[model samples]
Target chain A: MSRLSINQQTVKQLSLPELIRACTAVGVDAVGLWREPVAEYGLVRSAELFTSAGFSVTSLCRGGFFTAADPADRRRAIQDNRAAIDETAALGAPVLVLVAGGLPAGSRDLRGARAQVVDAIAELAPYAAERGVRLAIEPLHPMFTSDRCVVSTLAQSLDIAEQFPVAQVGVCVDTYHLWWDPDLDAGISRAGERIAAYQLADWTTPLPAGVLTGRGQIGDGCVDFPAFTEAVLATGYTGPIEVEIFNDELWKRDGAAVVAEIAARYPACVGTAS
Target chain B: MSRLSINQQTVKQLSLPELIRACTAVGVDAVGLWREPVAEYGLVRSAELFTSAGFSVTSLCRGGFFTAADPADRRRAIQDNRAAIDETAALGAPVLVLVAGGLPAGSRDLRGARAQVVDAIAELAPYAAERGVRLAIEPLHPMFTSDRCVVSTLAQSLDIAEQFPVAQVGVCVDTYHLWWDPDLDAGISRAGERIAAYQLADWTTPLPAGVLTGRGQIGDGCVDFPAFTEAVLATGYTGPIEVEIFNDELWKRDGAAVVAEIAARYPACVGTAS
Candidate 1:
């Protein structure tokens, strides 16, 4: 389980300490933490809690949402992302995942919104790099393109990432967000060293209303994990394969049980064989 | 209004006769029909009803779903598609919109599944052409990529359509599906003469649990109808612009009112302005 990191949101019911304990119990030494929980637990203390427990902080959960319509909202988003970068540095996380925000209220200008994301990133990437936190532009699924992230394809993520230095910016690869893409293999290959974070979550059907929390657990869906892992790994991406499912059903279950299920499925799915 | 067609599904609350009345009430003389509804109304009767009402059958609603796991099922699908082609010809509809089926039961081979679609289409295209029905491959939104339609982008639909003779096969340009695509303009331009049908539906958020019926009315959501219509019309497509929304809320409303709303929205959204 060396390469497997339990992204905290996958088992959101657990406290930071509890999450760390569970990961260690399952021999998963790596954990990806979200900014909210880290803020609640005290970022410095959280860092110490993970490091003291001999666990590696894989990556920070988020630091994007850059596409607000209003000028003040846009400014706030960039400033908040900058703070997330500082937190990423403090926590010793290598990357701060960026979920590009959706369109402004009732706006049809998708091209303009996407440009705003790039502008926000250009403003923040240098700050993030200076703080030693690489920004990972996470391209959410196209379903969420209009309301969530305009960056919907891995190619689009890489296109934005390629603009900056590789050390400062990279693309986040989440199978749940990207498995349907025919050009996924090419995107991964192209992402090479720019692949900062590699996340695992499956795409299940009958997506829940609002389509926020329907991500399937690894083996529960149709994603070919071995195929996906092989492609990502082939790109010299020796980073943690973070399990970051957002299923509403899973959240109702015991956090430990969920971790156990994820631990077992990882090796069988995108783990050792791949 | 001259270019506008009231797709039957847009006002599904109406019976075949009621739909014809509703359309004619609002001065819309063009329509696109679905097979199940046609079968319910008696295909010949439905054809006659539209013709007798002086309504032009713009295009038949569907006939694809080719990605079956079993060989026998594949054959059945092809046979059913052939019947649909005949129905289109009978209704004097020049196009048969094809919503390509999703992955077979418990399958992850998207490439293989897509190939199955091409194979099925190849077998049916000639028969469709002989019967004077052009099969329009309708690339659904990528959200339905796994369960509803594997063909999810305008470019991909064009790719499949280009393989067949332009008259025998073409692409369906639905605003709801293709609007999110960055390369949509390119795809529409490339599809020029190969554009068989143009469908309009707005993309609304807080998508319903099934996501099948979340499509908004013309001006109800984010779709810039004028832009979409301009792009499609630029391709020399002189066919009826069909309003094919699948909103649950719209379905609950009075069919005649919905038709009136659509009729009003058409001129403002995609008609005279475009």
Candidate 2:
């Protein structure tokens, strides 16, 4: 119960104040937040508000999109990421999640795009570390490879993280994005202490358009939460297990009700595996 | 030009006679057939129709789904796969593409399901080899990993293929599925003589529901066809290069027109990468 955190996107319909209130109602003391809504709520105010409300910021949603080939575009992306890192620091979030951007328009060089990700991270990692924030490389599912992320496997994320200082860079483990991997257990074992943040969203079928917003609730899909939780826990990870869903169906429901449901499912589906 | 094979699903709107005429009109002498359509057109008749039309059958559509946990269900799958292998032989298709089944209902054992695929293939490989038909394990995109094939990488498919006699088993290299993989080059190089069938499809986004029919037309998406062709060709794979799109828009168009577009795009996007 203490380890469960609800990422704001799971109840996207709620405003920051609404979310905080809902969490208070449901006895959720922690949450993961996205950049857009956090900014909308006034960053410093939200940070102060969460602290006063007794909520821990598990992670900050994003800080990457470094695949642009154009130098100017790349510079803009880097600047934006630096701002994100600063926001993460200000919000008392130790981890800033990164979604490596998709292929630039008309680009065929996936290798080139991936190289760009490495270079950008190299620039940002030091800044993030100085500010006491860790950059979490979140490998989206392969369906998003061309349009969202080149980092599709946990092993690949670990490969990037290993090149940097262990304290500064790490990878996000999300069941929704990685449940399909056969080499997952090995990758998780290898990730060990480099595990920055742990998230859960089940793999549901008939994926909707854009393949985004179709994530299932914890118990509604095929992912074995116990096995994943056990693997991450085996790595000595005592961090929060964030419930991060992007389902349109869940978003339309009452935010408090959704949080309550998540609180219930966390125990039943993700059981304490230690 | 001589190596191009249009899989039936690419132009699924066309009947057997219509597809034959469409190919003849465009000077296409090779095709990949699907089991359902072939059965619909009569197995013996499809074989006769194709042979008399001077069309080489590059590969038969499918023959796997061995993840069922029940003994009775497993036996039925084995029987069905045997029939598919027989159909491959009858059609003069040297390869039978196998889409390994997803998790059995309510099961979280992805490793176990994958093992089932290998075991079923082991059972079917000798039978396929006897008939001069090679089993080609087709690892679907990770997006299909749950409801379709648990085998999500060419490397994983190759891992399974390596277990059997080279003459009896191999893998289908599909551009759409394998393009996202960073280790694809290594997988293709390792495949070498075991590359039974080479397939092409682009990775367009904003994927529709079910994700079954959203495959892109050859040059319509992000796949680098030349890179894939060069790698496969470098493996000494001289088999027909199949264009297998599952696009909804393409299916709605005149089938002959779609084939003509594929023929044009094959040269432009795929090129003669010898």
Per-residue lDDT over A160-262 for candidate 2, one digit per residue giving the tens place of the 0 to 100 score: 9999999999999999999898789999999999999999999888898878999999999999999889999999998999999999999889989999998
- The Cα RMSD across the true interface for model 1 is 1.0
Clashes of 2: 0
For model 1, residues A147-261, the per-residue Cα lDDT tens digits are: 8899999888888889999998999999998898877788889989999998999989889898999999888888989999999999998888899999889999999999999
State candidate 1's DockQ: 0.78
Report the lDDT tens digits of candidate 1 across residue range B1-274: 7888888998889998888888888888888888999999899898898888888999997898899889999999999998999999999999999989999989989999999999999999989889888999999998898898999888888888899899899998889888888777898999999898889999889899979999998898888788888888888888888989998899999999999988877787984445
Which candidate has the top score in DockQ? 2
Colliding pairs, model 2: none
- B58 in model 1: Cα distance from truth in Å? 0.9
> Candidate 2's residue-wise lDDT over B125-154, tens digit each?
999999999999999999998888999998
Position A99, candidate 2: lDDT: 95
Off by over 4 Å in 2: none
TM-score of each: 0.98, 0.99
Off by over 4 Å in 1: A271-273, B271-273
